[model samples]
Target: MQYISAERYGNSYRNAEKKRYRDRSRAELVETVAETVFTFCAFCSVLAVASITLYMVVNGTPAVFRVGLKDILFSSTWKPVAKEPSFGIFYVVLSSIAGTAMAVILGVPVALLTAVFLAEVAPKKLAATVGAAVELLAGIPSVIYGMIGMMVLNPVMYRLEQRIFARTPGHQFTGGANLLSAALVLAVMIMPTVISISETAIRAVPAHLRASSYALGASRVQTIFRVVLPAAKPGIATAVVLGVGRALGEAMAVSLVSGGSVNVPLPFRSVRFLTTALVSEMGYAGGLHRQVLFTVGLVLFVFIMLINLSLNRILKERERQDD
Candidate 1:
């Protein structure tokens, strides 16, 4: 070979080894830092959730236990204005349940259908547009929804009383701000929640599953119902739980539309929900009245926790079935 310069050869060889070593060192540092960051973030998030829940429980438990379960839940009279007022949370429970039930009945079908259309049938451009619109709906503030219900929806319901009464026929009740109206308002308020969660669940079903179903001569609708929805059932259940939680906790929207009455409702009669009750009267409450509000908050917490626990159980069962 031609004579090579000694210094150049030595410099090139050293540079090559140095470059390789530098790369290896840098990769190791990156991996170590990434692992540390991930663990810290995960642990911090868990701690935050636990801390908040514990704080709520600490503040709420004293009132709940002292009030006794039955008196808190069954006694409908919520007069805190009297001396030595007792806390009763049953009406709140009823209101939460009624509102959540109405939301589920109205929202589930619309959300499921919208999800199906997006995931299965819509053209790409149309699907994108619709999905964006759904997300936007979900992102709109609850306060704005409350304002709209007060200004627009309340008047609308007042006008539609005759139509609603006509549909019921036997009921001669004549009031716009009532249980029915509150339920209707709650239904609208929770629609975006169901739609967003359901859309996510539907989209999570594997494309391969749908393709396999179609290859066996199933139509699109058949494939969707039999293959996609069933596979995503657990996620769908979770979505329902989440929507119910939103409906139950909704204060401003329900308060604005709901008649601010603490009495247990007749089917067409106006009534206050637990959330609305707290919000409506908190401004004027003192002493035991304040404690009663806390009790309402506690009851809502329990309701939401139960829903979440049920959803977790559902998901676990689904997982077991999958395995």
Candidate 2:
């Protein structure tokens, strides 16, 4: 082969280098744009949370001071529009806690068992059908749940209420919409979330773990309960935390069935939860009345934040112990 001239060789080398440079530049530009977009999305999420937190704090704190912190928090009176408007929310807070707890109690076991069935026992076709149904349930609007609760569950609750309290002396009737009815509705509302997430978590447990358990002479049920469940504990806990959050935060569905009364959270008693407090009275609320509603929002926000933090900490500790 003939040797190339220096100028020609130089020109060829430069063109190759230019082509590589252009390609690299294009790739870098794409990467930079992608990074920027992702960063912007993340920033927007953070900003949204910060804005809500700030707004709640700003709107909520002044009302507490105006109403007196102890009176607002500890007192049970909630006659917002009465002549001597006492603005206590103790009972509302209690009702929310009781309702959420009751919902969790009724919902979590069914959700966990259903999740286990879907993950470990169900055939593929059956699992798919059930999974689709669960997703559909999740997708159903809160208002629809409320409507169903009002139409179907309320009458059942009313009949049960009459039967249970008819013999009790001086027992007051709660019609149909009451704490128990609301809790039942909340349990149903929260189930899909718990089931979907728990199923996902259980399915994520490695096949090798199941195989190893079987090799050690463990039955399928034993392996699922002892090995797979332990491995999937974190995810299950996360699901439960999310479910609890959903129950606590629900406004529309709870408001529909909860009777919107500021009473003690007895099962047969008509009552309002913290979420319903805001939902029921935000309209026509003026001045300190409106501010008090915002205060309720802040308290709810704090409750959620505390619960999430506590659950997260427990999860971390559990993980560490397991490790």
Candidate 3:
């Protein structure tokens, strides 16, 4: 009887040990799997950023060196087909600048007003509705915006320009598709971004600041311009930068509205922006022409980088000031 009992006990102990070992093995496998997944996710993110940046740098640098920075930017002629293609990228740059400037001029006020209305004036329900609309606009595809410009806004602008010039004789309307038209369209496209960012910035300013301004017998307008905007300068600057970046890189809408002529900027003349140049010609271009287009893209990338860097520095300084 004693021998049988001992054998049974030993069998039971062996089985328990086996079960414990299996559970530990499963736990280790789960941990390993979790770690591997996390590592993979991290690697994917790094690879994505690195690949895009690397591609831009590699493709763009050669164009920059080939063009000789000064001549490429300042040269008047951009004939890219000769024994030696004299690639001047300035015409597009001018168009981009003009369009961006017009966008800022038109967009800033409307954005500021919309932001103020949402942040300070509107009731919660009204604000929610308006904010939703702004977000919807932002989510709309660029192609759709371009289509709208081509179909609706372009005609309207054309008529308006004719009327304005007719009434004011010798005030040349230039053409329907010029800097003014492109800028206006760009302004419309970037409005949502500006409004959304500016509103958030304004709303973030301490409520107490406005109340204090009121206590000091300040008008609403005064409080807004003086207290709110100044205090929210950093955030507003960020919003402007964001808007500028969008305007600078905009291709489809600008392409549709801008006359796509490769000429030095004339106030009333239709012209091509760098982005539009790429979109319009990339389909047909090959060899050196293709490289030139890529180089234009590189120039655009550099502009965006500069804006981002400047914004970051300004924000950092603002944070330091606050500290």
Models ranked on lDDT: 2, 3, 1
- Cα RMSD of all models vs. native, in order, equals 5.6, 3.3, 4.3
**Cα-based lDDT for every prediction:** 0.77, 0.91, 0.84
How would you encode candidate 1's per-residue C-alpha lDDT over 39-151 as one tens digit per residue? 99999999997986887677766766777768888987677787767667677678778767876787778887888888778999999999898889878887787777777
The predicted structure with the larger TM-score, 1 or 2, is: 2
Q: At residue 300, give the lDDT of candidate 1.
A: 77
What TM-score does prediction 2 earn?
0.88
TM-score of each predicted structure versus truth:
0.79, 0.88, 0.85
Clashes of 1: 0
Which of candidates 2 and 3 reaches a greater lDDT? 2
User: What residue pairs clash in candidate 3, if any at all?
Assistant: none
**Weakest 10 consecutive residues, lDDT, candidate 3?**
167-176
Error in Å for residue 96 of model 1: 0.8
Give the per-residue lDDT of model 2 (tens digit) for 289-308: 99999999999999999888
Q: Which pairs, if any, clash in model 2?
A: none
